[model samples]
Target chain A: MIEKKYEFSGVLRFNHWVRVFTMLVLVITGFYIADPFIIPFYSSEPVDFMNALWRSWHVIFGFVFVASAIFKLYLFIFDRESENERISFFDFIKPRIWVQQIKYYMLIGKHPHSKGIYNPLQFVIYTIIFITFIFMSLTGLILYMHLYHEGLGGLLFDILRPMEVFFGGLASVRAIHHATMWIFLMFIPIHIYLAIFNSIYGKHGTMDSIFSGYSWHQKYFKRRKNKK
Target chain B: MQNRGLEEKLSKRLEELSKQQGIDSTKSIQSILDAKGFSRREFMAWAGAMTAMLMLPASFTPLVARAAELSDRLPIIWLHMAECTGCSESLLRTDAPTVDSLIFDYISLEYHETLMAAAGWQAEENLENAIEKYKGRYILMVEGAIPSGEESMYLTIGAHGTSGEVSAKKASENAAAIFAIGTCSSFGGVQAAYPNPTNAHPLSDVTNKVVINVPGCPPSEKNIVGTLLHFILYGTLPALDAYNRPKWAYGQRIHDMCERRGHFDAGEFVENFGDDGAKKGYCLYKMGCKGPYTFNNCSKNKFNQHTSWPIQSGHGCLGCSEPNFWDTMGPFEEPVADKIYNTVFGGVGADATADKVGIGILTATALGIAAHAVLSKIKNPQEGEE
Candidate 1:
């Protein structure tokens, strides 16, 4: 028999989607700021501030993304409902689980059993994505220091100046910031495809679980047995 | 004319001061105001402006003036390599102290290839004499990149066919301080750009000394003068950034002080040259301005006697002062490419490299996902009974 059980809380779902939304906004605005693909024309009154407008939005959402990430980190550590997700770290470290996960993706083996919210691969990939997010934030702030005479941007100068030098120069820092955006772009499609793949092929209602915080699985699944 | 009158008096005063401690360079410097039509007030005003340009506090103006007038006229040897002599021209063409002040009363410029009337064996003798007399005391100011790839045949100076690199190294070995006077000397300007056949290198690269880089396409006259004055006053090189450029002048990006920055913040940009927005003094960032990334005091300092800078003239900054700018900040108008590993996939343009990699991975991902889904369906035809 199939049984339904809660898998995610409302907070986790909200934060997950917030991350997706912000990443999209950040990428779109970032690309426009980098290239300004818009052909400019002579405007009599000169009201168009497209690059400035996009950059403002990018910074605003960047703060939101940072806050959301912090909140998610807190939840990952202390929230009871997130214990399953935290357990994924253990599976991620196990060599056998990685072999099984790779084999499963290669279509040569069945899915590896785990007592966690995410598979080993998802855990490893998500960890790297979060680390990249932190790196991007630091580099982005360093670039932002170019615009201000004082205040937060100015205050950041002491710390960021040496970092700029360490990275070779401001130009190199900017290059790294731009390159990391592509990493996010590449991760998104594959992340979506896998999420959908599991929902259909695994037959566990994984897609609906993200929205409703519940999923149907075999009553005798090992995870359920362990929970009892 | 008036400056020439001052020079004569200064030389006479130098003869008097020379008897005491060989410090004849100072007495005449203090008497510069008494020489002709110029006033002490005019000297002070020039000194104040120079101090301000050096990013020094207002209180330092008097100190700067005193240092300028009373300090020993240190010997300076100006060497030209693969350069156009534009840096020398910029100094000579300015109107403040004018070229007369730089040559006559300024540091005793003993050997300058461009300015010295001597040539052939006579000029070579002057350089040798100055180096011997002031060895380990004279300042060595290099104005161009040194081509070391050949026997330095690309640019040879002196009668002995001595390569530029060899000559520079020899001069720097005994110099009190070394000043790299232009982008070519400081950062290997145009000659070091991509496909650098001559294998040129900046003064710092060719020499072991800590080079004080006054970098610009041709650095502003004041920057060159200010650097020399700072050395004379402090008896040490000015504070420098990571690129060895003076922190006072290159500490801030041009974008910070740009007048059109309001347009940038407001998002108004000139789409093209001679457009209405261009006429209205909009930001030139859209037209490939590198001001946002370039660090220099150009906006505040200006060029040609504070008349205007590139942005004021309705063009974007070429980021000429930064290191390896030719290869790194290219296609001039577009933002620099975001590559951590520059020169990794050699010969590919920055954006092209990113584009090829991004598109390649995205395409492979899409195709792999599609094939995997199709294969899964074929393998599980009878298993779907939901």
Candidate 2:
């Protein structure tokens, strides 16, 4: 059995819990806002209460997204990275390695080909989601700008015209937003399922590692040298 | 001058040659001239101006020089049934140089219930006599839908015109070509909405005749003017849609042309009667405005002397121009479900707007982070080591 150790720090713990908190805010409120059928509350005004609040929350979380992205990017480019814990562009396409990472946990394979901070699959998905969130942020800003200044909105509209028309104009843009919620929703089950599975199979109790800023391996272990 | 020798002599001959449309055999043109109601010179001058008026942009001022031409004025019959006289009022309100009354000039206005001063038996006689004398020659103008529930007594044309103006059905059948004015006459209007008590139907539905429907609660006067002139000069139906109404007038939805459609796409909405949004003149659709579905020129042409319309009046359009609009369309409230889900109608309803997009982005990002946290915990035991 491989030895486990606690290596996470306090900053990583704060980052993890806050990230979870913000993500929950984004998902529940986001879905409620997209369809508005989520919760029913009587409103004295013609519009509902949660509806009015969604705007403030959305802007607030927009900054959350912006901060997380900047912080994560900073960590990727400049943080101390050991040879066994590094990310590379080739991780985007290595399907066999991803499946091997999965199979090792499924008990379908013997020794796991383990040597990195992020599993290749995890690295690829994160990279994609990071870029996609940037895209969402851009489009969201363009749409928000529409409310205040139409000239700026029009310029953004010109850039998004293909997306706008392809999605069938303004209506399609809305649907794209609404439909994207499902993407997050689908991610939840797979995310939780794998978190539980890897913790059990690896005997690492990995769930609170983000909150506590540490993960458990098998008590004590010999560290390897750099790959490059 | 030698003018009298040839030109002057020929002028007299040309004047004699023009007896025109109304010189009945009972009254010789020369004999009436001698009796002196309107002198031949004055009568010819009036006729000359009327002839010139046809090619004129659209005005009552007679422009023709004394050519002693002929009577191009077609015979027209205005028929009213199952209607408030609003369409007639719109016609009368038509811009000066009065296009509606000019329609009177193009066609001999032998009988009209609203315009003609003649009424009762006298008016009834005119309708009968005109329809008789100009059977296949005159055009019949119908305003308002024809109610089919019970007896023709549901509407009475009063005894005007020559034929005693029977039920709207009989009158519609006897006409040369029918011109159905107003949304009511063209598409049964609000009276024809679901659970229609009157069972009102457009003129086109009542008879097989290709009725030219000019649909709008009160269609724009310019549309009326244009259709009438086009018919007079060419004697053919203007381009028509499936409804048989002239397509030139009714081919577009109000949203396609509205000034505030920009606000609609951006998800801006007027949520109440006097909110800041309403004052801003944003889309009334959230208020159940039907501008999106209603097809008419009300927004473009405007109403009440071209000043403002429903959306401009701070209310959403009720889509009065569309068939059964009162039933199918809610006054400009939230867009229909399809608009919310499948369209750029922008972020669901007007109230939801930017928030929907914001929520969507936030969820995706959060889930990405969750997904990564879980995956990271799995890889950490060995992957973090070097």
Candidate 3:
């Protein structure tokens, strides 16, 4: 019952890193398009197209983000590897896990008895983050139509027009999209810190497991000590 | 400043053109154009300009001109509420001053406080007569925000006991269609900005009618004329966007049609006023230009007869044509901040604050974890391998 158990599958790890890379591209390019901080040249001819270039990158990556999100959603639902992740939703809402997680994060309690790969808080937070990613993708495309007049961007106009109105015009849509970016910005540091914290504190090689697809189960340490 | 000289120059040209066409201000459009002196080709050229401003095809020029000539004169009831009269002034400053002024002759202007010769009770009587005579037939044009608080005492017309809302409601009661002219009337312009003390409301919000918003600080002369002509010719309202603005006028962002858009796309920006970039006509995106988000044809349909626009004059857009622009599109020279977080954190500014605080928290977290690791290592030397 205690061994190096496979936690993240190759596909899940691929999706996770792809999301990270696309998000990085999106945030940098999006911010530049929102307000270009660097003035490469103040008096360049109109043909420079720097902002347009950033926008193109932003939009191109935007689709990649969308595709990755959709693929992640597909994997979440249909892939057997994600069955535990799906069931973690129930554990995430459990009152006992809530209390245990709070105590653990506060450093007052040991890791609670858990049946899922992700702890309750991680489950909850990741779920919310993914939901936000979906929203950001939709709103981002809605705002993108402002610049694009033909091709795939133009085709999406029929759909985004009504959403733009429902969201209270372009300004509000842009504001919401802008504000959500800060969420990801804040999430990255906390996410990295927690990953490293768990890896080092539990001696579980959790960080390496993302790439290696196997983690030394914490219970394996207890079983090995008993055998010794 | 320079606008004065531009206006004088524009008026002089209009005068000279009218002389060449033998147009008399006293005569109607039909009379002047039909007169032996005025050619059909000249009229067609003017029609073409209006068509282009309306975003209509070249083929629509003859159709628009024919409509202008054959359409029945619309009866208009112009009402002033909580406004600065800027919309009216814009109309007066039209490049083709003679023809733009002739828009009055084409419409039976039942009541106009600024331009009507009638004064005092005579004006009141004129309004009443127009309403009674053209009930359900005239175009009711409301030119400012309608104050709704404290019995609407914030704005009143003449010496009567009538508030703006009251008068607007009565006038629009039986009108065929209502036109909310100017940002104030259409979207509560400046009066409806934050801390709107007067409780100003746009015409659509105050009334249950199908209101058409010709929103601008003051819309261009062509838009005003185009909207009126569309109504006159088609006997129905032009297509409207979600904001109730005519789609042709407010369909696209100013950034799309801007002359300086090349600079914007090229990432060349004017960082400050009178800077070399600004002097050299660089994009004003960095200087808080709201053109990218603002949906108006100001670039193409330049104010004062295509003379200039805000961006052309080397200033960022105020986003005047947009709804709640005063409240939403501010700091005028800086991008809008995330109000919730900025205000919550005592307005230290955006992006930078988030970045600093984010980095600060992460650094503290790292140090705390490091210290904890060291303490644990001292107690249990094998903690890393545990």
Ranking by TM-score: 3, 1, 2
Question: Model 3 in CAPRI terms: which quality?
Answer: acceptable
Fraction of native Cα contacts kept in each candidate?
0.47, 0.00, 0.40
What fraction of the reference structure's interface contacts does model 1 contain? 0.47
Q: For each candidate, what is the lDDT?
A: 0.78, 0.58, 0.76
* Clash pairs, model 1 backbone: A49-B267, B288-B333
Q: Write candidate 3's Cα lDDT for B1-386 as tens digits.
A: 65456335434533442333211235456675565345777778878887676666676676567556532345678899999888878777554544555555443455688988988888888889888977777788889998995848878777586888888999989998899999999988999887898999999988898999999887887777788777754566888877888888888899899999888878888878998888889888778788877888888878776778899999999788888888667668876432223333454534343344555666776687677666544543254344
Candidate 2 lDDT, B7-108, residue by residue in tens: 454445335434435423344333434454445566545444333333332232221222212212345677777778787777676444332333343334
Highest lDDT model number? 1
Worst 10 residues of 2 chain B by lDDT: B62-71
Error of 1 at B232 (Å): 2.4
Better of 1 and 3 by TM-score: 3
Q: Which candidate do you rate higher for lDDT, 2 or 3? A: 3
